[model samples]
Target: MSEVDEYLRFFPYDEPYDNQGEAMDRIHTSLERGQDVLFEGACGTGKTLSALVPALEYARDAGKAVVITTDVHQQMRQFVQEARAITRQEPIRSVVFKGKASMCHIDVGYEECQVLRDNTRELVDARQEEAQLRERERQLLSDAQDGEERAVEARDAVVDELENVAERVQSISSEKNVCEYYKNNLTGNVDEFYEWLFDDVRTPDDVYDFAEARTMCGYELLKEGMEGVDLVVANYHHLLDPMIREQFFRWLGRDPDDVITVFDEAHNVEAAARDHATRTLTEQTLNQALDELEETDDPRTKRAANVLRPYRDALVEVYEDSFGFGERERVGDNWEDVAVANESGRDDLTIEFLQRYEGPGYKSDLEAAVMLGKDLDDQYEEAYKNGETTTRKDCQTLQSAAFVGAWMREGTDEGLHPVVSVRRDQGTDEVYGRAELYTCIPQEVTRELFEEVHATVLMSATLRPFDVTEDVLGLTNPVTMAYGLQFPPENRRTYAVSTPALFSSARDDPQVQEEVGTALHDAVRFTPGNTLVFTPNYAEAERYAQRLRQQGDATVYLDEAGVDANDLRERFTNDDDGVLLTSLWGTLAEGVSFDGDDATTVVVIGVPYPHLDDRAEAVQQAYGKAFDRPGKSDPGWTYAVEIPTVRKTRQALGRVIRSPEDIGVRVLLDERYTQQSRSDMGKYSVRGTFPPEERDEMIDLAPEKLKFAMMNFYQDNGRYDGPPPAP
Candidate 1:
């Protein structure tokens, strides 16, 4: 009908969906118009094609090279796989840009770096805090007419906590058990918070806790970092947080804004943004700094003291107002915290806030506040600014506090939570309150972030109310596009079966567990072949999977030790004959596929929804006030729950009956679906075939029975899609 439509007809893809067509048109128009595009398609819509097809075609038309990169080797390979479909149309050449550290020797130089210099200042701050702790201890010792008992008791608590956490560190992995060279092997449980702080180390148990380890270990990402790339897929951190961004751009010194960014599994953006905002302070720093004032004599140490003198006043003010100004600090037995209720400057913060606090556009207000404790060209400007003075004070209190305010720095024993300090690892808990983490919000909007890029496209199957992702992710003002695949129910039999089991929220209830087991058994039997049971939550999934395994044969329930989803997929793909018991958090629930004879029955256990997430909790609270306010539904939950559920459902359903001959049953077990007049699944919901009254019978349809029915339906409906992409 049109030149673009005509061009599409010759394209190798057999059939496309409503969203896919819309997205392609928008993408084509954007490139033709010479406007940058930020296409936010949901997962599964084949958005990769929307960007890729245009990239390849453009490369040929313009006689230029095309480079494409995703987050990892697999992702890059996925793009290469897509390129083959159109390889006949245009030749493709690509390369993987990996960080030097990926190969073994780390390329990051630690000597004479401005960043490392800042790190040195951290040690100086820590030394100052240590001095204060000594001062507090001396004060407490002087007041303890109660003798060593009180001091010993307080001191022991802190030390004991450290010992307890050290005991809790996990032993070496099972893979290392057979090695004669097995190194440190510590077992048994201990206090984790203590080790994370006093000792300040990130162990394997620290995977999710300290974010610093994730950053260093993720040094693997740099191996793939660099430019002249067509598409770059990365975590939200790469583009948003400043500390991560600075190093991120180091590997690829070229304009990072040149390539398009596509966030896979993008619902996590809000958390990424909030993480950009939290700040913390350590109790150790307060204690140690008091000690340092009494203990240190060097000009360097005194200089460090002068810088902290003001913040110390702020702390004393908060403390005295809360605790009624009492001068007593010492190891009461360790782990003793004494905050005063009324001190010299306790009321100063309110004064400071009133002097600041701008409404609505508060970013400028935040900027002005940061300028207060920073190095100004004019020294008098520093005095008038708040606490600005010489470069030394400018370096510690003023500059540090401003840095903390803008970047939201949270201090700890090691300074920064869920992030480890590389500087403090120099043996002994030497530097207290030394921050290992540095996170910052990106000033650039997604559009502004990539304004320098020439052309781009983004697509996914779950792109609904598409504006949600676009607006939040800073992609709002871009040429919008949508491309979809044929999503109608296939010759495959689909059922929405209700389970009798009530979610126990209480795990110890055996009867509830049994009911889940029974439901899983009945659901799994409908197919003449292997089945996959999908649980919305990890605990519930594992519980049911364990229950099923008790009466099982050829069932594979993965170990509690979390395995990467891809590895699990390979196992599922290779061993399609076995029943796969997978949870929402694990691999089987999303991304990977289980189809044809390998999986003939798919059992969805519950309505996947947000249960517990602080960010989500905060979003619901804030968004409620931001939108409807006081009394209303959450805009956050609608996106977090409804949207994610729709995406999950689409992913689970996609797993079964790959081809017409390859038939299977997809059973959604939640009653929540039945309660609604229509689910967000829209036409993809099971109602198009089975009447609500006969919904249970849909489960009985099974693979053998459904294939015959599907053959008849196809006689009338025909195949919505012609064939699968060639392997």
Candidate 2:
């Protein structure tokens, strides 16, 4: 056997599947060569275990550290469990690190809780020394003949309390202002604490329970122990934030060169980074800042607050005048003209007025206000730590000023857009407003994050059309890997619901809506077991659901706007037979699994294209620049609209069959999927080609064909090669 085969023999799972073995080899090789790898593996390919085994193997052999971060903590915990199982079979060690906020033992802010933790060790040592002296005295007193019984009782009481330190220490610590468990155990036994903590920590709740039992801060213990761990599992935000990254490095006493980072569900990482980079200033934020400033004694902070209040007013005026109340209007692209109109001044006057506050003197005011804001925040937290009831003022005016001032002066990157909108109450017309600076194309951010690690791996199921993802995510010509179905391909099928109907916004009349609704009602009625209907928007979903109800469909569950989504999902999954109507990109589209009879069919309506508003237009223009689209084609629209639509549709389809034994069918309810030409409209306007010659997974929308194909596919369980099966 070869060296690679030898390594495979040690894989701690129930033997890697065919596709899994290939993925493992590719991941190991890429990490060895220090090349970033973008891997697309389907759901049942064991992507997590595949990535973990090879990455851990590489780390073990190379004496390097590995950090596995995902978009969700549940996934992180799942990974940690898998890593632990692997370690049981190997000689590697792993650690799971949730952020400070998550692992905090107290109901206090991170900064304040950290302060309490910092001094805990010293306090515990001093308390322990005192307790030892008391113990000696108690023993001596117990030896005396006079009052011997009372002395024994006193000594026993002291011993009992000391023994119960881990259990009742939290209350003791609160009463005496000392962490009793820290004094008794964690002060000198960091490794022992981890052993106890991880002994039964299968989830976040388990971590909290274990720590609470010992009255120890899980964050501190886990953080201190991360240095000796071979693999660390955490959420993506922990590594994406620069401060958190630096803090982790300091804890490890190592640099970026010694680590390999694997971003699971990496398709979502760029979007997370983009969100991290975005900032918003809400009217509530401004009001809170003003309230805090008015209560403060500092004249400079008060002066800054005075200017900030008007700035807030100016922003509100802009939103109200430009977009009107209760309407979502896009902000204009011309910053100077918008600013002039909102401030009710000429361009030069507006620039001068805003710049005056951003100048040297106002800079001092801004800094002072920010410093005071921190002081007040810390004060409130300290009071909370001391068991005093304190109300925190939501004031940070200078911070808002700083963000707005910077954006106004420096403008935004080519890809990012600044937006403003106003929301008003129906009865009172009380205005709540927001201003946001955001970016849809996250390639620049993704590129920068990749540069921080020695080697990186981006993995997802729907990262197909690998070249597009590579270009869109700004990878450095990395090796692209794809893994096909590990399950019976015959168990799954896709069909186009071809009807001469218009579902686009251009034909959003009640007649078209009713026709679309009727088609969906019919599809749900025909399909047995559990069925999921994906519409372009909530309004449409509600319409279709109403139509279903009118047609005597009692088992219709509509995803209402602003409802608790988890409850909705639970209700849908718990029902053995029903139809669930949800919008595309809603909670049901992704990050959910409805295997077996839970979801036997998925029906998707028209493409869920985003509105071509100002922010989206800005992103499109940015994409044009990023791809350097000097040709006739619009790269922006393709990247922002077409790509996302396909990806979301694919995500919806993916939910149908989650396991090897699962069977399901996918129905596309739009004419575009059935047309010979790529048609955005009914007239058949092909972009470049119809369905792209390479993708052979599409089939006709005939009902009989769909039924026959799905039934036969499941019955035969035939293996799928490269071509589509005959209907």
Candidate 3:
């Protein structure tokens, strides 16, 4: 039997699916060889269980810990529950570790609470020493022969006192209401607590209840318990953060080389890592700092505010000029503004002065201001720890200053890019300026992590085109496995509209938007039960929703900006028949699953593509320089645009057909899906010529033809007996 077969005996299923067994075998082989693994398991393949069972089994047998990270909290919970079911026979321990902000009690700020933890540790040590002293006294009295009767009485009293000590340790939270969660779980023998917590706790909620009932800190308990856990489940940021990663390994009592890391829905890692590394300062945030300064009596904060005022105004002025205060188009050169903000002769400026500050170099006004900001941050943080309350405003100012200092210090690095922009609300005419320092390439942040971990398994349902992902994610010779859709081919019918007008980015034009809208309406008019209409962006989704509402034919639900995606999904699913209009980049596009009749039709209005603005072009250029081959057509556009679009489209398509028995219709309202082109050898004469490759999928049919085909398919294969409800 193969490795997967050995592990399959532990799973709840009598037998694994063909793809599941194959994926498990590949994952096991890669992990055992200490190699990075890239896996693409399509929906309905039980990707979570397939990855978790073998990974946990390997960790258990190898005597190593497994750190599982995913995009959302819900996914972490789901994975842990599945893991619990599979590991029931084994002694494997698992816990879902959430961020302090999520799991912490509301009484204390996360930072302040962290500071309090130090004090708690000191208290626990003192109490343990007292208990030890009592034991020593009791033992000495028991050994004395002169006072045998007194010794007997003394020993009984000591035994009673010891029992009281145990009771005090267990119920310390009752007397001390502050952070009872931490005291009860963290005060005792740590290893015993780790084992007991895992044995009793199955989910995050369970952990919360255990902590709350004892009035303890759930966050501290999990952190302490996580050191020896077989499987530690958490959101991506927990692993991505260098500080948290350091603490995690420390708690694990192991080196980074001993742990295996698994990232589920790994396609989202790039964005998550980028967000972690990126820093921004906006007008509203800075203004809050200014307000906070007014309430402070500290002369240093006042002085720092004075230094920041001019820099803030100058940046805002440039932003206002570029933003045009709700004008139809930008009015100023953004590149020039960036140069001016950085106080450099070149558009791409470096913080060379800040780099060699103590050394001989000419310091500009901006450099001096940044230095002052750093000093203020350090000074204020020290004050906050010295019994002075760190007002939320105080923290905000410190954060803004620290970000400014870091950006000014490292903005010149090749991995980092600086951007300045403004947004104006048309209704309020209120403009907010923002200055950001971000990484266009996530490799700069992720490359070190990949090299540090012993082994990593990155898996997702929509990680298509292994080469693009490999290059973008900085994976080196990874063992890759792509499992085809496990659901039967006939379970989902995909169609592309053969309209005269193509649905491309040019749909911004009123006429094109009208045409696409009509084509979309025609596609879903005959579909039965629930139908989901996905647009390329929020604005387009709203536009289509408005038009649909104007028709006054069907009950339409729009996933607007402020509305919760989950709540909206629930509302639509609960209705007997309705339409849910949402964005292609939304939560519903990927993780949300639909059963037999609900969400039976998915109308993808357009090929989701990023707008070709300055930032977009810069990203393409950066990728072109980094990944494009010397003697072939640049794959920059493909990496930056085409691949992401396809991945998102595939995710939206996957949402409908979640089960083998569940059937759905997929409608593509774009003609671009049918188009193909040959790379002109003449155009590439400067470099070596190459053969043309196939383009995107082509499931084309005229509007009339598409309507008829969908109707026939629904009538023939749909679970519902009647024809589609009339629009």
Candidate 4:
């Protein structure tokens, strides 16, 4: 057998699917050549094991560790399970690393936990010093009694300080302020835990249980076990955030070039990178900072608050200038209300405007405020250490100052767009202002890490149009592969119906709504089991739900925003004939399993275009400027709008056919999907966005013919027991 065949022994399955074998071979070849891989494999292709096996084989031979990061926490469990299966064939150690906030036993934020851990360490050290001083004092006194002149002077030096040292130790050893779990970890023997961690593939929950039994910190134990592990499963922040990434590499004791990294659900990497780089300072936080400073007795802190008040007032004036304040208006008889004229608006923050406050005198005051904020933070820490404060509250003043400092340092980058906006809280309906430095390009955050890593693999089921992914993420020349659905085509039926297009312009037309409602009623009535209808957004979902209830006999369930989505899913899953109406971008679209008889039909109502907000407009403008070509069509619409919309629509369509054994019908209820050429109505048709296999199989039909197609499909598959329903 060849070397590749030898490495295939590590595959846990009895046999590999054709696509899985191809994916593994290509990935293995790429890793050997030290090249990055961008792979798109459809569901049921066994993506996890296919990527894991070759990565493991390469890491072992190359003396590198495999680091797998995912966007969802639940994916970590899949990694652990796959690792366990691999361990059955060979002895390999893997550790599941979680965020500090999740691994912590105490109910506190990660920052607060760090403060507690620091105090615990200081208390332990102070007590040890006190004991040593007492012991030395006794020895010195004994020597003085023996008539040693040098000892007499030493005794005098140490005698008067014993009481002060005891008091200091007492002040630090506050049980209310210190973390006992961390204190136990300082001396806890992890020999047994370490052995157990390496003996099997342990998940984060398993580590938590074992650590709780031994009264040690699970996070610390996981860090300790990272030294010898062959695989490390962690979240995206561990690799995307700079500070966390630094600490993560430090724990591994390996440089980036010594490790192979795999980003699961890599489609989210762009949004995740942008999120990590974005920062905001809110009006509420600023007001809270002022309140905190006002409550403090320190004169310097009070002065700092005075310096900040002007900046806060200046920002408020900017908000008013951009979007006017709420106005009092007469309502019903003897009633009045305050209505905000402009609920949301964004305005550019120019350097000229910023320099007005950043000039010499104001700059000095700002620097003083920063120092005073630190002083106040230290004072709060001392209070916590002395047991005077039972809980730690972040020094909001320090947070505000630090944000200003960061804005000054990094806000000038071309990729960073600093703007102020007036936003209303959804829950409270209170209008407030905030300043944000938005990161437009994902490459600004991801390029360096990809370059530094030995090899990288980015794979997702919906990742397509490789150039867009490459350009947006700034990936260099790398291996790119796209795989079709592995399931048999005979079991799945997809149709693009010629219904009234549910474009933004046509949604409010009553005639169009009736025609679309009639089509959906017929489609849902023909399906044998539960059906899912995905709209573009919640409002549209609710609108269709009402129409379906009025026109059809099937039970309709509408997804509401802010409700318990899991409970809703459970109820929908239990009802065999219920039709669930949810948005394409909602919780049920992605990372959800609707296998077996759960969702036998999925109807995507329209394209899931992102709302045309300030941010979306800015992204479009930025991409156009960055990627426009000389003679080709502009890439702004395709990159920023059309591709992402199709990806989301496909994600919703994928909810029905989860496995090879599953059978389902997919319907696309928009004319744009089947349009052969771009017209004045729609510039781009999304039918080309689909994979070749799916695009070739899609049958276009009129709204009246959809019921017949669905009926014939179910009957052909032997799933329908009766004749077609009356039209």
TM-score of each: 0.55, 0.80, 0.81, 0.88
> lDDT tens string, model 1, 1-727?
6635644632557766566666666666666655555455433466677665555455445443333433334454465456545544433333333332332222333221223233333333444445555565555556555576677666555455544433322211111111111110111122342233223212222322332332232222222223333323344555545565556555444444333344444344434554654444443453454354445343334443443444444444433343334322311232222322112332233232334433543334334433432433134333322223222221223344453343332222111222211112234533222221322222123444455445444444444455555544455366654432233344455554444324436345675455556556655543455778777667776777666677665556453455776666666657644667666555565555565566767777766554644334434443433344344345555544455565566567656755546655666665434424146445323333222322433443322233344334433444324531121
Task: Give the local distance difference test score of model 1.
Answer: 0.44
**Cα lDDT listed for each candidate:** 0.44, 0.66, 0.68, 0.80
Error of 3 at 132 (Å): 6.2
Q: Which ten residues in a row have the lowest lDDT in candidate 2?
A: 336-345
Q: Supply the global lDDT for candidate 3.
A: 0.68
Cα lDDT tens digits, model 4, 219-277, are 98788669756889999999999889888987887888888899998988999999998
Residue-wise C-alpha lDDT for candidate 2, range 1-727, written one tens digit per residue: 7545655634766678887788888888888888888887777888887777778778777878888888755466568677767766665656677766666665656554554554465456545755785676567575754656766767666666665553344543553344444444455555666676455324556666766776766666666666856777778877777677878866765678778888887767756877776777777787877876777776666656756666677666665555546444333322312222122223332344364444355556556666666676676555544545333223375567666565554344566566665565456556566666666677666676677777888887767566667777777878788776677766677777554444464446775666556556555644556789898888778877787888865388889866887788788888866888898868778777777778778988776665566666666777777776455267777766666667677778788888888877777776666754354453332223223421465676553345455545544553233333333
Top of the candidates by lDDT: 4
- In model 4, residue pairs whose N, Cα or C atoms come closer than 3 Å (at least 3 residues apart or on different chains), thus clashing, are none
* CA RMSD per model (angstroms): 20.4, 7.9, 6.8, 5.0
After superposing all C-alphas onto the true structure, candidate 4 shows an RMSD in angstroms of: 5.0
Deviation from truth (RMSD, Å), model 1: 20.4
lDDT of 4 at 146: 90
State how far residue 281 of model 2 sits from its true place (Å). Answer: 2.5
- Model 3, range 600-666, lDDT digits (tens) per residue? 8888776677666665565676788788686536676777776777778777876787788877788
Identify the candidate with maximal TM-score: 4
What is model 2's C-alpha RMSD? Answer: 7.9
